[model samples]
Target: MSNTPQKPVIGISCGDLNGIGLELIIKTFSDSRLLELCTPVIFASNKVVNFYRKSITEINFNYQSTKEYNRLNNKQVNVFNCWEEEVAVNPGQLEDAAGKYAVLSLQTAVAALKQQQIDGLVTAPIHKKNIQSPDFNFPGHTPYLKSFFEAKDVVMMMCAGSFRVALVTEHVPVKDIAKYITKENIVSKLHIVHKSLQRDFGIDKPRIAVLGLNPHAGDEGLIGNEEETIIKPAIKEAKNSNMLVVGPFSADAFFARKHYDKFDAVLAMYHDQGLIPFKALASGDGVNYTAGLPVVRTSPDHGVAFDIAGKDKADASSFLTAIYECIDIIQQRADYDLNRSNPLKKINPEVFARMEDEDIRE
Candidate 1:
């Protein structure tokens, strides 16, 4: 067998064909340096790729049409044509056909992931409204991927540089967020975030900061009792279980004073609580990563910009970051698993004996 480590094959799901999905993919892949990192397979039709190439920038990359992922070419972009049916390509238009094809592309890519044909998936933005179907009845990709992978729980963690954030309640209405902030939900999410930090991000002893649901952490129960009843108990339980978790911190001061830098990750109570600060801090370079999934998945922390679909005004920085994040996470998970299975057992016999006895006694 060759000694060279095989590069990961990242599946790129073509989002709404009418939006800026293909545009971002094409632009990001235009840089030849990216090819050296991992092979990319766009889960879209050759016709759609050609349509976007002609409409957008004059990129010099070529794609090979392949029916099976095993035939993927490492030198060129691979277009795993999901369907051959002719479809309209109206940039910036939101129609049922665009939604239909988007789902088809995602479903095909997800199947490939389950088969291990692709090492990771970097999804493009899909329009939430028109993409609804019997198969994809969820509100967004996070939940869809959660159910697809059959993961017990997943965290919608957003990352950009030093700042990392995961939400407890995502895509739920503001009015209903309080209802979802129960003790069980908070504890489950905390465990997911903590485990993902160690396994996926390579943090050996992860330090997670949990944000309070109410402003000022309910000002000590004057604003709300969630901090006292739900969040505080969860934090206590996590710490007692030997997890390096802290806080019920006030959301405002947490980010305002740059306190997020003190920890490996932050667990915000709701969508806006986490994302508002993450987006503001990350600018346009944030990547949304689904934690606790058996398969790796990342997406640009952005939505399909229907207005700028064909104008080439869409920024590819976030998409590029998502690709890099997926590759890094894949490598990290590999290292984590290897370390776990073959841990360094070089401790002295006496020290090892003592540790074992302590564990047994406990």
Candidate 2:
């Protein structure tokens, strides 16, 4: 076998042709420095790529158009045409055509991921409303991937640097948030978060903080019973399992006090409770990672900005960050699995001898 380390093949799914998905993808790959890290395969047609490239005249985006994956160029960006038919390219439009094609790109990219054609996936943002259909009925990519991979559960984690916030309930209404805040669900999410922190992030012992559902963390049951009944019990269960888990802290005070910096990750109760703070604190470099799945998947933290669809004003920082995170996680998982397979390979002979000497002395 060759000893040379191969660059990972990263699959990109053009989220919505009408949105800023193409714009972001083009801009991100325009940086030649990124090409040295991994090979990129974009799941869209050459015509659509040209359409977006024409609009963004400032960027000199170059790509190789290919229908076959085996002939991909590692030194250049590859556009894998999912469909050859001409489609309307209406920027900032909420038509069904754009949504239909968005689903197709996602499905194609996901199929490649399942077949091991790609090492990891970095998805652009997709509008939740227009992308809905009979075949693709999930609220967002996280749930859709969960069903596609048949994973029992997955955590939607927002990461920027060391600040990571995970959601317990995603895309659900505020009124129904309490019903989903059960001990079982909380424990399950905590388990996923803990494992992801260690495996995906390369942290041996991770510290996690859990947020409360209501104000003041239910004020010890004066405001709501969830913190006392549901959250506290869940924290206790996670702790008993010998995990470094803490809190049922008040979301407002915890963030205001900057308590999130102390833990490796935080688990929030609902959507806004986690994402609202994450978007503000992440400084536009946030990445959405789906943890606990068999396959690695990540996306830019923002949605498809229809208002700035064709405009060259959208920043590619978050998109670039997502791609970097996907590559890093792929490598991290490989190292983690290798160490697990041969635990003795990681132990030093000196350390083993020292332990034996100490035992003899005792």
Candidate 3:
């Protein structure tokens, strides 16, 4: 860690102004520990930021916008206003301007990421179909960014403190889940999840649990054959590569305390398989992370929460966690890259092999 270079810069994608995105952003950045870890910048409108602050806090922002990170800028919140549009910009009010502002914020943040101005990104939740213009017709943030960056390895992993789950298929219907479930898709997500645990979470050997598509792991092939056909081959291949991969565990039993403690990350077959428990335990505190991107990207797990917007009741725990996770990922990635440069000096293979054997023995 001491040998690793550079503090992470966090770029926040401002979501819908009508949603609680602004409130959470304002509240989370108010913490001083956040400033110590990374330089926080907002890709949003000054007007929306100001409106939310005054409405929620009942006062002007204690900080001001700046161009760079410095001792003086540390206490202030900096914003890069992307859209120059003017509208009422009221909280709890859904308008096309609010939707447009969301896109502009993401565009500016993505540009900054590509230009190397920021180390990572933490996006606020945006209303997917609402942001529907001829230009911005993507389903959700993960797919939208995946398409724009042309990322083959891009996968969505949701986090709440220590619990992390990666999705094989996201934002698709339950019926379509069967159609999209394939050997290639399963293998790809498994690889991404394994790499993310090693790179982002600093886990030298990640124990990955692959959840099943049907009840009781398809009741031994009577209910479904995805377990026998698609999943088993992928697990066998991963183990042959010296990866600690396991299961087509029933999603219901796996979330139990006795079961989940065994693995580093759970690979869900579809959206609801992973998210049902994620949203249940973490709820407002869950954070969504996009694994396998060239840069780190995370966001609050929950949606816009338009119903509670301007009520000053939105929780900022997930937003703070997202920011903190970005910092940790950046630091970890730096160490991973540095270690790669000096691979000859890495930990001895005998020692690693012995440790792997010890873990297996346990």
lDDT top scorer = 2
- Which ranges in model 3 have alpha carbons more than 4 Å from their true place? 1-5, 58-60, 66-75, 344-362
Error of model 1, residue 37, in angstroms: 0.9
Q: Give TM-scores for every candidate, taking all chains together and pairing residue i with residue i.
A: 0.93, 0.94, 0.89
Best by TM-score: 2
Q: For residues 1-362, write the lDDT of model 1, one tens digit per residue.
A: 11122588899999999999999999999888888999999999999999888876567767789988678998888999899989999999989999999999999999998988889999999998999988789888889989988888888999997579999999998999999998888889889988988888877788999999998999999998999999999999999878998999999999999999999999998999999989999989999999989889999999999988889788999999999999998888886776576454345657657877778523
Report per-prediction Cα RMSD to one decimal.
Answer: 5.1, 4.2, 6.0
- Candidate 3, residues 92-173: lDDT per residue as tens digits? 7778878887888888888788777777889998887678899988888887888778889678998876778899999998
Candidate 1's displacement at residue 8, Å, is: 0.4
lDDT of each: 0.89, 0.91, 0.81
> Deviation in angstroms for 249 in model 2?
0.3
The CA-based lDDT of model 3 is what? 0.81
Q: Global lDDT for candidate 1? A: 0.89
Candidate 2: which pairs clash? none
Which one wins by TM-score: 1 or 3? 1
Candidate 3 accuracy as TM-score: 0.89
Task: List, residue by residue over 105-172, the lDDT tens digit for candidate 2.
Answer: 99999999999888889998888888888888988899999999999999999999899999999999
